[model samples]
Target chain A: MATNIVWHEASVSKEDRREKNDHGSFCLWFTGLSGSGKSTLANALAKYLFEANVQTYVLDGDNVRHGLNKDLGFTDEDRKENIRRIGEVSKLFVDGGQIVVTAFISPFREDRQQVRDILNENEFFEIYVNCSLDECEKRDPKGLYKKARNNEIKHFTGIDSPYEAPVNPELVVNTESQSIQESVKTIVQFLEEKGLIKSGISNGI
Target chain B: MATNIVWHEASVSKEDRREKNDHGSFCLWFTGLSGSGKSTLANALAKYLFEANVQTYVLDGDNVRHGLNKDLGFTDEDRKENIRRIGEVSKLFVDGGQIVVTAFISPFREDRQQVRDILNENEFFEIYVNCSLDECEKRDPKGLYKKARNNEIKHFTGIDSPYEAPVNPELVVNTESQSIQESVKTIVQFLEEKGLIKSGISNGI
Candidate 1:
């Protein structure tokens, strides 16, 4: 009877997937306060990589919660669960040999560390989209800061909730000072330097 | 200083990988008692898929513990961690659009549920490799039954620990009477039915 169990397994090996993609895939975790341009940067990075024929996907805070993690809430436990699911999803992309760019407030260090531990050591790259509370508030493109000030939003990372900056992120982008084009250029250059993109892959014009 | 922080990003897209692979990928979670032919069936399944030009990988119990899951143990917490990591890895494969086959003595319903919860509902396929303890002992392919009988292997499932059979598995393969070839054919048929694989794909003959 032991011979009767039929299991449908993976069709491709991990190495083959990586090779077919023509570049190593890893998690690009972006952490910052809301309106710090994390999602903007992540989107642009994904577009640039895609144009260059790189396999890429973006997991922004808003997009993921809308679908894959819609059941979660804003409470501490829910936030942790939210990040946990994202970490698992990101790990999936990395394993498939695709670059994954995730942007979230991700205020807690322990949660970020949990994500790192889930993936391989070198596969996780934390990018702190560093912008001061004042700067982020000024650029409150979503008016989230105003809502939080009016008590319309509770546990806002930079307000009632705390935003613990990464002690040592892979890249620190000051979104307040850099132009969007410049920021994308910097990120694209970083990806090229990391050999995620081919050498001399031009940033969008 | 920046070089110290590695940026891990994939240079490929999910659609690109899927187009190249010519099939969508998913995770096949196989649960059963040791010596029940989970690994035997998983290996044969992977081999068959590989030959058929489907990208595949198998995370067998012994192989995973020896590498990806080395830090874990038999304790409940460790077991949770073990299943959790496997879930993460499996998700990675699915994202890369490659089918992943995992075989473990994942004894508890709760643990298996946790894994399923981590994965998408449609992406997770639970295959129960059903073999009676009496049959498993008779097979004793790894001499594990002998070890357990001698008290050399403590906390062994179906001996010291409980082995909760899946109540409603997606597929039940009775290893007692079916031949290995029959088992592989059944699994492949399931995949084809699910539209995961094209019919008549030469799975490595």
Candidate 2:
């Protein structure tokens, strides 16, 4: 069946997209516990990049679960499938010549690794949103920790399920201590240093 | 569990993205049978849109099945799931302020309607790549038609399975008669006329 599938060569390649957008395309995969500021940081970075005339988009647990992965649940297998789909979608965005930022708890190391392996060497940047369980629980931005404590939610990362920290992530933002602005600065600085974007007068807050 | 999920509002909205791109964001969904020139026409439009400085991306069966929808097969259930996922992904691109063109066989009207229902009225443009099966078989761009005739493939659209055409598609490109350039010009003219794109000196051939 696979043999019957023919490859259609796209006249416009990723290089063409990048040349048009004036920046390289890649995925910024943010993995961490709930309330670790993954969504916040990802959105902040997206705004920064967008203002800089860089094509950018954000995919997070909230927006994704409501749409593409709506049928998926919180089971371990479902979680893996969720991340897998997001990885593939991110690849598409990168291929379209846009910077895609994805935020998910993504609790397992192998699951995150699978997403990274699907992209080219420099196309996937795994940014571990590092925060202690205590800090995340304290932030309790969505009251998820309270729900987990009350036994209302099962397999909650950092409470019931485990979150395997990235052994060697491309970048680590310690959101527990760093301000959101600082986190955005760190990421934008890395992007500039890597030549993903041409350095300009910083528009990032 | 649902109560624990809070929507994080981004500083950037779809309007912001559109303003930055200097064009409106929407999905140009091309539906037809295999060998109907959907991919060809979609890529042509994408190239045309890209050259116009409008952020555009093409999502077709070949590239999508190889990645995001890799797990899906040609089964009825899988096909429905495939289109559902594509609709959601297209929404993401539209939200990011891009004109996304998707080329899929998407033979089921209900499935196509499901995708249309997911987007705003004007945001989803259903383009029927109209071509008779006999014409497609004659073209036989991928030689799949021969295999289908030999019964080497199961549930081959227009061969064994049914293809429910769109009852009231936004536009129809009769690829059987119209050239690829003509098809692209028709679609681009529609976009410009609908004010989906700002009119410029037509670069289309």
Candidate 3:
């Protein structure tokens, strides 16, 4: 079916969009166990970048599941498809000249690697949000651990299911030790040091 | 798996991004048969809007299928899923504060309505690229019509399958009769008249 289709090139390329936005575009993929503060950190970073006039967007698990991945379930295959779709969407956002941040548990190394393979060099950054399963269970911000313990929810990451930590991520932020503000600062500092954003932006104040 | 998930609200919302970009965000869905100039018109409009300093993006069939919808095929169910996924992605672009244009065959009214139902009023504007099958086949930019006629392709819209035109589209630009420049001007004028975009932008010249 795709053989007959021809690619119609866009007049406004990613480089042009980046030049207009005054910043580089890339995807920041945050993976970790539940309650590890991936969503919190991603949102905080989005706010900081927006305040600094850097074009950015965050794709968290909840918001994405409600729309693009609504039809998917919690099977291992579905989980892989979920992360794959998110990676593709993030690629589109990057092409549109925005720093796209995605937060998900993403419990498999192979799935994460598949996402990375779809992106260009330096276009995908794996951010490992590190927190122990014990800490995550203790937090239980959404009472998910309790349900998983009660056998009410199956395939729960860090509970019944496995979470394969990143082997060599671009950055590692331990939410158990660092505050949300500190985590956001570390990420922003990394982006600036990598020349993703302008060097002198007051660190988002 | 989703029970433990909590929605983290973004500090910078679509409204804030729109304000920063100095324009509103909406989707211009271009629907018609293959070779009907949907991609051409959508790209023209995107370039015009981009030159006018209006944040814009075009989501076309070939590019999207090569990435996000690559797993899908041309079956009826797959076609519905394809449009559904595109609709979801376009919603994301709209949420990111961009005037997103989508080009797809999208031959079913019910499927198109499903997409329209997902968006709020004034957020989705369907543009019907009206062109006769004869004209489109004669043009045959991708030689798809020839393949379809030779029975090499099955379930091809307007040949082996059906194409349900929009009953009441926001606008209909007949590519057979109108120049691409005229078609773009009509659509842009409609956008301005509907206050979807700011007027007095010099037609992006």
Which residues of candidate 3, in runs, are more than 4 Å off?
A1-10, B1-10
Q: How much is A96 displaced in model 2, in angstroms?
A: 0.5
Least accurate 10 contiguous residues by lDDT in model 1 chain A: A1-10
Q: Rate the local accuracy (lDDT) of all candidates.
A: 0.77, 0.87, 0.87
Candidate 3's iRMSD: 13.9
Judged by DockQ cut-offs, the docking class of candidate 3 is: acceptable
Segments in model 2 whose C-alpha atoms lie over 4 Å from true places:
A1-10, A201-204, B1-10, B201-203
State residue A3's C-alpha deviation in candidate 2, in Å: 42
Pairs with backbone N, CA or C atoms under 3 Å apart (clashes), candidate 3 = none
Residue B197, candidate 1: alpha-carbon lDDT: 81
True contacts kept of each: 0.03, 0.26, 0.29
Question: RMSDs, each prediction?
Answer: 7.5, 6.9, 6.6
Query: How much is B154 displaced in model 1, in angstroms?
Result: 7.8
Cα deviation of B205, candidate 3, in Å: 5.0
| C-alpha positional error of residue B76 in candidate 2 after TM-score superposition, expressed in Å | 1.1
TM-score of chain B of 1: 0.89
Number of the top-ranking candidate, with DockQ as the measure: 3
Error of 1 at A106 (Å): 3.3
DockQ of all candidate complexes: 0.11, 0.23, 0.27
lDDT of 1: 0.77
